[model samples]
Target: MKKTPHASPAAAAFVLAAALLGAAAPAVARDNPVDPVSNPDKLDYRDVEARRPDFKEPFLRDGVVSRPERFREIKPGITQAQVLAVLGQALKQQRGALGTEWDYHFKFQMPQSANYLVCQYKVVFDDSQAVRSAVWRRRQCLDLLPR
Candidate 1:
């Protein structure tokens, strides 16, 4: 009688899994610029600075703390994700049966070392996840709304 080596069930399963994964690996590696698992060093960082609001823009510095004009881009039909892309992130969020709301706080620059003005920007979103409205208000800063 001749004896022959046979793969166990587990060993056969491992080999089949490896073969399938290996076949798909090349296709994934070809198009992706940065591979978190195999080639993380190639990850791009060029957009990191661009995504930040520029300090040179005075409106951004005084109005919303950063990128106040971005608020103007918001419209009734834009989604939550689109709003995030424009506004970076909200300082606080509130959700209710009517819709969701995001708030960002801003501080005013005043003279004579008096207490600075504080303001809040509110953005509301409907159940459909679309922007319903955006507003900024402060009782003290009524004279200098965007200052």
Candidate 2:
């Protein structure tokens, strides 16, 4: 067998440590306080109950399916909130993506773990629509609940 290029253990450890140190870190959310909408008196329950949630807003949730089984390794019918929770962590790490908004078609993928759901969409935009009509994949599932 031909001798492979061998790195000394100390050199390898230093390289690995430096590589990790150089990696981009996720930004933390600011702790500034803001008023909550749940002031109680701010809403009349009777009136609020009569109104429907607006679906036209961007990033507003449409629905969720748990562990949908259409894609390879994704479970079926996972909820929208669950998907968002998983993706949100990844979004913090990646710099290229400005934001993500999705409407689940609920293709019914089954036997998926609590993590990793594929969302299919028509378009993506950044700060401006600089990247428009661009379809892509978003990695989620860091905090996927144990099935």
Most accurate candidate by TM-score = 1
Candidate 1 residues 1-147, lDDT tens each? 999999999999999999999987854233323433322233221111323557455443233544333556877889989988887688778774346878666665564566555555567788788987665543343344343
Model 2 poorest 10 in a row by lDDT: 39-48
TM-score of each: 0.43, 0.17
- Candidate 2, residue 25: lDDT: 60
Assess the local accuracy of residue 115 in candidate 2 as a C-alpha lDDT between 0 and 100: 36
Q: Please, what is the whole-model Cα lDDT of each candidate in the order they appear?
A: 0.59, 0.34
